[model samples]
Target: MTLLLSGVDSFTGIHPFLLVLAAAGLDRLVGDPRWCLHPVVVMGWWIRRLQQLSERWAGDRPWALRLAGGVITALLVGGSGGAGWLLEQWALGRGLSDLRPAGLLALWIALTSALAGRSLEQAVRSVLQALPDVAAARTALSWIVGRDTTELNQAEIVRAAAETASENAVDGLFAPLFWMLVGAGLWSVGYGGAPGPLALAWGFKAASTLDSMLGYRQGTLLWLGTAGARLDDLLVWLPCRLVALSLPLATGCGPGGCLQGLVAALRDGVPDPSPNAGVSQAAYAHAAGVQLGGLNRYGDQLKVKPLLAAGSPRPNPAAVERMLRLSLRLELLWLLAGLALGIAISAVGSVQ
Candidate 1:
């Protein structure tokens, strides 16, 4: 059972790469639908339900309700990981090879939970296509980002889209993989197999949910959401930097420029209010040779934030396409790295 679990974790770790390939193929075969229901969507649905119930039960006590909601949200997130562990155990006990089609299928589902890949690209593209003339683009961008886009010009629209894409690359792509690696390492040390990749997926989803729901600078929800947001920030710290570094490596930005971009991002990105998001946005903005970060709306509220990167004039539609292409390249690089690591680990274990 132990060997099987370890083998499964090692084998299934490559699922991210395979899934990306599959999704890309799917994208090419059929055009992207504007609305795809992700696993996180289901998670969000349940979280909102819990929040509503909490509010109902503790109508007079906002603090109590917020606390209850936070606790419930954390449990759901952590429980998803435990559930994955059990599933891995069940699969191992059934004598299914870790690399079998069934195992791969499980991994694919788990990777999909990460919510890092194609959907994000499509979302940005949708806004870009609708921009400058379409009211729907303003609404769509409003949904994805906290920025105010009510009176945004074309350049501002492109900057907002680019910024959101770069930030999500950290949260959606790199963070889940970081947790997967952590879970895999722990699994190897103890039970000899990591839980299904879904464990990390659920955990990240939970964290993301909490961050979104309660991670505001003001109001009663601040303290309650602090731990989740901080933990998320810590988990993505390295991965965020890696995402930033990829900007230079993939975009032909030299090391000197990349470092400069990194420093500039670290110094300037801090002004955006999100602890970790600015780093990647700043890096990508510098690498792409465009300026990012500016004033925008969060609902009806206007947030005037400092700019992250200083570069040429505003981005046009072509620049939007370029950013997407760069993002795709970075995604591919990360997927390839994951697969290689998985293969190497499996080979080493086999020899041992």
Candidate 2:
């Protein structure tokens, strides 16, 4: 599906490569623009409002919570797609139905806002700069990580930052792109046709946001958030493995080293706690030359997860930067690979 969309006759009406490059530039220079109007932030606010308003009526009942969650998911995903379609139409109309400056700009904004590579890097860099002051670093890290940072040492903080950054390479970037591509082909052939990449990417974001907000194992969210969490896991499963498999080639790590690290990751990664997180974390831990997945604190509870790359040294500030670099490599590789495949698919479609 992704291949078809990415391959379709200008799936976005803009050259895929040019559109992606523009989006990347946007990510680097304006990333979520702390003060600017942000789509995700707006979605988050709406989700929160809907959930709270429903809670007033749903109370603590499992069915009510679950129902509320379902409603939230539908609203967010549907809303994003509708909004994308509307924007695309406006852009296309303004540009005389051609993918010129106006349409291209709209596409660029949608794709750019969907990515978080720069923002995530900036966040980890903050922790790195705060350094030696574990307290300051922890405070900085807390914004990015969900784990308790109050008792963490410098090493733990760096590890969390690196791990999150590496894992998010897929979440904040690839997975959404994958879906956008998948939707492209469908949009091209569907009734009335649609401008796909933007709509699909935002739809993916809706799912991810829902999982983050409601997908918890404790409290009312335990039962209510189950659907959101599972949906996120299902959508991300393949992308995680894909990223893990390519981590070596993307980072330009030698086969000998990558192979060795992959062995460590397979032995340690597949069995780790998270249903999907370990897949990416394993390759990242090995490629970044850092140890991950030891004991982590979540509030008063301490959980000891399966360790990865046990032979490597503990993560440090250097490891954080290295991991971030590796993640970038993975994102680029995925983009290029997808583009290549898309070209082939588009050719195939044309022949048919």
Candidate 3:
């Protein structure tokens, strides 16, 4: 089940847990630097190119379009994972000792590139900062959400912003973090020949990008995007649940609050079409004591989302701010938990 690398165990002087911490810190400090061609951008480019190619073959045949989509999904996911594997191999080479500074830096940058916590925060905050001027706020919100923002009132604007912040917290941060940790654990436990953190993270990113761009329920995308959308849903399912459960603890809420949040998330999120977004939004809505979900417009197709935290009040800028802060707190909580687990593993190894 695992691909054993050539001299896989030869790489030394690097720990993925440490890299995760370093990456999180660097991401918080610098956000995503746009000076370089970002990995997500590359993924987007590939999606566009591949989709065009698919169109040539698919034509007006629904069945053919669906088949082409599946092929494209396989190619993109495999390609992204392969890219990650190569990057790590190039960095680790025979060992970190040989590459030293360059190797470590490369590993750190690669891991950091997978996270978007800081960027998510900045984006949500931008909407808040542009508030009081409804139009400016709408413009800011438009940058982050797919919903039509033109006719939104102040409350709706705030609600949309909060919803996006919560949903993306799962998509942009926790999901990738979860995969990276899994990849790190596999590598650290001596599966070096297998896909490492970057491989898993980038693979997830590719799926996510596909869903965002092509996974629609209407028109041509209805059947063509099934594979990509389902793939993303599967990848996000566990992480979304984990985030929902741990969010209360991250906010320093006691057992009672945690239980309530989980219950709310399940009750509200289960009914939504998406396997993940509803749960994420519900958890944040409960945690922040704000209601979310209502009528939304995506390019003139009006859709109504199920209300989350129905008993709660509409979110304000302050509520949105609380959610952002909670996201930061949750990030730290998970990191600390990972640190503790790493130490326990080390202690057991020493005993053996």
Candidate 4:
């Protein structure tokens, strides 16, 4: 832990431009893979398995299920993080320079995999290409979104694809980076290198997994998933809103549109059930001059959400592409900012 912290602190003094260049290069080389067993995926599978087992034991006991789920969630999160930290420490002890071109290579790969930008772009592109055929489009959209796409029209398809892009910008990109920063800071404090970040990432993955598995409002899950859902919501609050605000800069929406979109989103998005999703969706709708929010079905359940950016232009396949482009830009901007901040802190500390 001490070595990891010292290494991170030492590496932080490197130039920002160099750090970003290295990270970006590594990201380009190690794009997201469909078959790769990502930590999040593994964690999710374990969580679901736990939930199922708990249900079997607890039966209809709502309180017992919830309590068990919470305890399990904590253990999974803590355990994964601890293991990741240990692995990171071992990797660093192998004498990897924290900021050398080669050192940056591994870090970059880690960051890129963490971001999931390429995977998201592929998902959006698949939806865009499928738009000419409604059935194909529905299938492709289903790959990325949780809703039923069968009933969607062209506009709705566009809206759904775009909304997913915007929302994922926070979840897939900024959220991980935020925790990475937190972990890096801890490393600087002498805890160790990437363990802090890895642990944080694992914790989030656990929370996200719980939300996905048991977070639904439906039967057998509402109580069990409530705590996990709320914790995930709380964890993502800042990143979601920050990404929402940054969308304008990322997508070329301009300050005026950004402000209007945020306000409009606030007015219209508040009615939606998710505490955090509306921030980005509303902002994107406002910025892109599109109206989003309407009836959505998850399985047999129908949810009528309040419209964000009401009366904006209807969306099309082109709109989906635009949203994808914007999200990519925003993610890149975030990456750059993180690199800059990390380098700045490292330099200042070194100077002192």
TM-score for each prediction?
0.81, 0.86, 0.95, 0.86
Task: Residues 137-196, candidate 2: write the lDDT tens digits.
Answer: 989999988889998887778788877877777788767766755554443433224556
Over the stretch 1-352, how does candidate 3's per-residue lDDT look in tens digits? 2222542454411365666778889989988987966888988998899888888878878999899889989999999989888877767665434455776687788788889999999999999999899999999999999989999999999999999999999999999999988877766665667787888999999999999998987767887788999999999999999888889997778767777778889999888888899999999998888899989998878999999999789999999999999999998988777666666666665677
Off by over 4 Å in 3: 1-14, 94-100, 255-257
TM-score of 4: 0.86
Residues 1-352, candidate 4: write the lDDT tens digits.
4565554433333332343445444544565766766777777778878878888888888898788778777777777777656555544552335335544445445545555666777888888887689889888998889998889887788778888977786677667666665665566444445565655766776677678777887777877787888888988887777766677786666766656555665676667778778776887777677877888888888888788887887777676677777766776776677666666767677688
lDDT of 1 at 68: 72
Best by lDDT: 3
Q: Among these predicted structures, which one has the highest TM-score?
A: 3
- Residue pairs with colliding backbones in model 3 are 5-193
lDDT sort, best first? 3, 2, 4, 1
Clash pairs for candidate 1: 5-193, 6-192, 6-193, 147-297, 148-296, 148-297
Location of the lowest summed lDDT over 10 successive residues in candidate 1: 8-17
Q: Cα lDDT for residue 336, model 3? A: 78
Better of 1 and 2 by lDDT: 2
lDDT against true structure, model 1: 0.64
User: Can you write out model 1's per-residue Cα lDDT over 136-232, one digit (the tens) per residue?
Assistant: 7778788778766788766677778888877886787667666665555444333335554456656776777767776675554554455666666
Q: What does the lDDT come to for candidate 2?
A: 0.73
Clash count in backbone of candidate 2: 2
Q: Candidate 2 vs candidate 4: which has greater lDDT?
A: 2
